[model samples]
Target: MESAIRITRETEFYQGYIRFKMAVTNESPYAVNEVTLDFVYDDELLRVDRYEPLYVEKKGKLHLGSIDGGKSKSIAVYFDPQMCSKGTDIECNVAYKDYKGKRYIVQMEPKEISVICPIFRTVSDINTGRLKEILERLPHSESCVFEVLSSFDMFKLVNLSREVIEKRNVKHVRTLYTKDKTNYELWYYGKTKVNDDNIVIKLSFLAVQHTVELFAATQTAEALTGLLADVGKDLKVTIESRVTGKGRFNLHLINSKITGNTINNLLDQCNMDGTCDVNIVIDNINERTNAGRSSVNNTNFLNEQEEQRLEAEKQALIKIEQEKQESLQKEKAEKELLRKREEERLRKQREELGRIQAAEEPKRKEEEYARLKKEKERQEQLQKEKAEKELLRQREEEWLKKQKEKLEQIKTAEEAKIKQNEAQARLRMEQEMQERLQKEKAKQELLHKREKEKAEKQLKNKNASTCQKINSNNSKSNNKMLMFVVVFGILVLIVFFAIIPAASSSEQKAIDESVKGDNYYNQGNYDSALQAYDNAIELDVDNSTYYHSKGTALCGLGRYDESLDSYNKALDLDENYTAAWTGKGYALNELSRYDEALVAFDKAIEINSMDAQAWSGKSEALFKLGKYEEAQAAAEDALDVRSFG
Candidate 1:
């Protein structure tokens, strides 16, 4: 036979109820007989009293009255978990006995049990008699006696609870002892019952400490006896208190006296024992009421009175602070109300202003149009006057050109006349040359004779080699001076033409490219316009306006990434440029980088809040990021700018 056990939580922790189930399967060879199922668990922290049983087939059939081998039956168990906290796990075991008197333990998988603490009170029927009052005072001391003796600090008593004792695992229970006071040991007791359906479980606990001098006197002992008898009628308190002597001191209720004179009689009875009996009840009352009264002095009393006054003053200060806070809150609320009213009034004024502006816009535009028409006519007139001035200047240039041509012709004619005069002079000089040549021919004949004679003399008297060397040296010096002048002239010309022109042309190209790109961009041929703008930037990378224009063109082309890059370039060139920041935000929004777009928009707004495009772009980005609230507010902010669409 197969049997299964199931543990389930019935009620929550506060209700203290838990339930279980048992099931048996039938597949055995023998005939079925009676079987019993028992559910067991750890009843330490919590105890269960009753459980319902299983009812199988009727009339003692094959599977009735008991479970045979290979036969199945089901049973249940119910309990309470009154002390269990949430998520506590409890385990249960089940065993069954068949009709053949063979016991079989059920093998089943373990199940996890959870207990939820409910809001209801745990104990239903609490016996609040004399014993109950003593049990309620089980955990008595506010602070640990040992820790207080060691540290002498009262701070430990503040915010102390059961958690502190449990954390420290403090085993010693707290109780007060007095040397001069009478001994009346106050003990508390509690009891718990489990698995008893006949009676509800009630726990009565009494705490008794073992000490040498407890109830040392007969009168005190008698007082303890009378107190215990009046506490419970059927209370069975476990007494662990120590006896003063070796023998166990047992009190018989029938022999005990109950009158106040019984203490006096017990003292007299103990007179031969050399100990005077004292009333413990009176001692306990006095001890509790006059705890520190014996140590009071005049100085201490005055200090205490002053301390009380200071404490009262402190309390007054706290109350004043609380009142101040309340008043501040009230004033803040009032200020906020006034501010909101002012804002509403201002908003209405702004709305009125917007309406007025809207109503005046067309009239203003019409007047502007008339003014523009007049301005255009005036510009046309100015252009005509400029054209006439240009024509007059051109005519003056023609006259100057005619005069320059006439002067060139006259100068050429004078050059011809000078050439003619040079030819006539040359002819005359030839005639004189012929005459002089004829005379020189005669002189040469004479010179030739003198030279022959002088040569013959020089051949005998002079050194010819030295004179030829001096002539060669003079001719080389003249040739070197002429080459130096020619090289210096060529170097000057090369510097002017190559190095100077290269630098000047680079600068001129940069300026010209920027100007041309701006012209093309302003004309709105964005394709060629962007090309020109890129060319301008290539010539001068630091040109912010060129980058701005390129970014604008890229945005127009729907190339948001490139546009963002270009705008970033512009910002790098000029950090304070509002146009670049606004453009960058727009590009980021186009790419759906809403967070970055908002940051860029904020920067642009900081630079200039009147940037309508930035406002609108920020509104759109905020809307897509699940910030519909902010989006609506931002959209309203955008409409506040006149240029926002």
Candidate 2:
């Protein structure tokens, strides 16, 4: 089947998790259905922790419902990197059904993944032959090759190589291979294999001073080459033959043909006790053997050649030792000469320094004496100037004193004049205040008398009206009794027809005015509502409902004090009026009288437990009093009552 889906994926290691992002696109002309993705990886290397769609597990499968043609969907998978080894591979497979309901599967290529670990590049640029020679003499059984150079310390070289190996991920073990005061050896294992061979490079000191060796054992030349290639050119080595003084020795076995056994034999020959130098002469005696020579003569010639080689080696050793002694003597003489020259140079420098100091001493002392004499003259001049300044200062002080006394006199006269003027003003103000107080008292008395007379007159008129009403009612009752005796049915009809409708009409008119006031109050027109409520109260002075409504309107006008008075009046008319009590509480809360407000609210609540306004007013009072917990409880109660209603 032609590919219907195109998938691209990328992997990243972040915050200890290996996160994979995959972009899956439906490339076919038809929509894909039942789309799903499956991931697979080495369990030893990677562990799947989580995936998008939330429920994906190590089974590595994700179910994508569907994808429309030309549309794309993104999938993400996360795994723990710590669970995986380095250089593991992760694989992904995508399976989906096409529009025809035919199943199709796509296998994604496996991606190679690796974790970062410590690494150290190998070093080269070293003399391989001499290095091999030293490694052969070391107390080691493993087959190894080496490079030796004369300029580096063997111990330092070994330490540096160990440091590099320890930095890598390979498990390394170091052991004492050999122990000597001058010559030392160390063995290390758990070396990383190069070219499929377990090999380890090592360094150690040689018997010859200032000479070190670098060596490694490998099963194949290819392995050695691979190791050497990684070693690169960083480890610089310079080789010089002690006997020949020739350089450029290739350490490769194939090129040099000098095996480890050969090097060991050479070291044995050099190490013979009391022997200065011993050279082993290896010749191809077969090529030298001739048909004319006898076996005995050939043996004699070989022995002679060996004797000659031994003599030459002895002479070379003597020459070397003699030259070494001469060089040491020459160095000693040069050092003594240099020391004497340094002492002579220092002595001259010291004498010159003393001469310069001695010449400058008198000149310095004379300059010091001149400086002191000039300073003494300057001090005397400064003293004379100070004396002149003191006399001028005394004169200025006297003039200032005279000016201060004259100014004080002038100030005293001005202060006395100000006092006189202030006293006159005070006397005039007191007289005016007394006269005004008397006028105000008279005016208040007159107004009080007039008000009292007016109130008495109104009371008298009210009493007269009440008496007339009582008389009229009594006369009517007497007439009804008389008429009833004469015409009982007609009298009863007249009493009901005349008196009941008139009283109902008056009460209805008052109710209508109160209704109007309630409408104005509801519309937020406090002024109009107040006027309407006043008319209603005037029509029926004893109506507690009108008084309460008036208080509500006054509160709406922000006239809390006036509203309080109205509420008090309503309470007077009907002591159990809950609305008036709640209104009074609200007014007191607005006026910041929180303690009194709470009392009023409590009274209202006592009257009607289910009253939302009473509860709400109580909450406000409690909040003003800084009783937050009680306020919140009261607020909740108010909300409960309102919700129920």
Which candidate should be chosen as best, given TM-score against the real structure?
2
Clashes of 1: 27
Clashing pairs in 2: 45-84, 122-231, 123-231, 125-237, 131-146, 131-147, 131-148, 132-146
Supply the TM-score for candidate 1: 0.23
Best by lDDT: 2
lDDT of 1: 0.46
- Give the true-structure RMSD of model 2: 35.5
Candidate lDDT scores, in order, read 0.46, 0.58
